[model samples]
Target: MSIDAFAATSLPVRVGVQIAPQHALYPKIREAVQEVEDLGVDVLFNWDHFFPLHGEPDGLHFEAWSLLAAWAEQTSRIELGPLVNCNTYRNPNLQADIARTIDHISGGRLIFGTGSGWFQRDYDEYGYEFGTAGQRLDALARDLPIIRDRWTKLNPAPVRDIPILIGGGGEKKTLRIVAEHASIWHSFSNTETLERKLGILAGHADAVGRDVREIEISTGVELDFSEGLLEAQHALGVRLFTVGLSGPDYDMAPVRRLLAWRDAANA
Candidate 1:
């Protein structure tokens, strides 16, 4: 499907911030979350990882779901989740239950972002098999249904049907899974890359008897929106864009830029 075939541009633009859970104390991370919410960010995300992705390797980093649980209580309005939770770390049923609990805690504000595990060091140190990429993708494919099924069986179910956000742009298995399962699809792509993948995703959606436009398109953004990258992507059906902030000092400037852009675009 061509970019013109999709209706993503008609959707409301949303801004998200990923508070990198590295190189900062827990209080600082929590403070940043509060500050971003106060600044009117639409969504808040933290990565699912055992260690910092950048800066000092052994830096102070906290766990993902635990922090999400904390944030569920800490904020009353903003939606929160892992930017992309690694499917390998916990059982599918457990993930579903945890997500359900957090959804209730947040009064139905969980986004449930997940992806195939990638960090080999995290897998090795955590004693999980650091399998081939295909194998991991296969595992994610198999587990997503189990997670969804588990949600149905839980007592006092999730406050709402949580939106599943799958991140990754692999043309084969990942896009297929996104077509079948994801309510939101996130990718780190420029205009060229995203346009191509939307075509692929449209094909997958066709195969699955789903409308490609039904899935919300998301991407990562930079501090500088002056280049018109965000607008270009928005033109191609991208609705949600996220900016990543790292700590010690989680600067709010980029977040402010994103929010300003979102407001202007929406207006």
Candidate 2:
């Protein structure tokens, strides 16, 4: 898989910021969201988790969907959603309705990123079943179609065909589901891993009769903006780069650098 292989599908580079909702107050989180949106990032994301993923286990954290609804109203330009909503948290139809509602609220700026539920602690604490990885992925496969169908049956349809971003790189099931349902595929992969996964994903897409290049590739970034690293990813068809900022301080410097990189790359 080479960059030229995806050349016919040239995608504009996009930068996103994930504002982690743990260990922070609601007001502070709100302020961070506003600041990032103002900073001109292309997308804004918050993770779906019951508790903090890092640092203190009992840190102050907020729910994902509810905060997304709030963010829909809070920002106007950036597309918003959970970085990857847990599929098992709510009924698929209900998730669809909720996503549709938020899509309407945001006037069509929603990116419905979802995944097979993980994090045993979130399941244990919230009373949802903690199944095996395969089981969870099976559930995700079953529900995605239902979610899409429910979107059609809603009283008021979504303002736009809500873009579905499936997060994960499990080559067997996850990539196949992404082939069938996703508009974007989000993952954390280095250059070699990304190239291999993209090749696997393309095989899956072929099996399902889809063009893999149609799916946008997204990944996270660190503070140190390595030109060589990003260039390698760009060559392998990744266009959407995201950087996550944790609570308390929600630093914007790295985000600014990524934004600048995005502008330069797309220039």
Off by over 4 Å in 2: 1-4
lDDT of 1 by residue, 8-38 (tens): 4467999999998999999999899999999
Error of 2 at 189 (Å): 0.4
| Candidate 2 per-residue lDDT over residues 1-267, each given as its tens digit | 333455445889999999999999999999999999998999999999999999999999999999999999999999999989999999999999999999999999999999997899999988999989999999999999999999989989999999999999999999999999999999999888988888888888888998777899898878776989998888777889999999888989998888888899999
Task: Report the Cα lDDT for residue 50, model 2.
Answer: 91
Q: Which residue pairs overlap in candidate 2's backbone? A: none
Estimate TM-scores for all models.
0.98, 0.97
Where is model 2 poorest over a 10-residue stretch in terms of lDDT? 1-10
lDDT of each: 0.91, 0.91
Model 2 TM-score relative to the real fold = 0.97
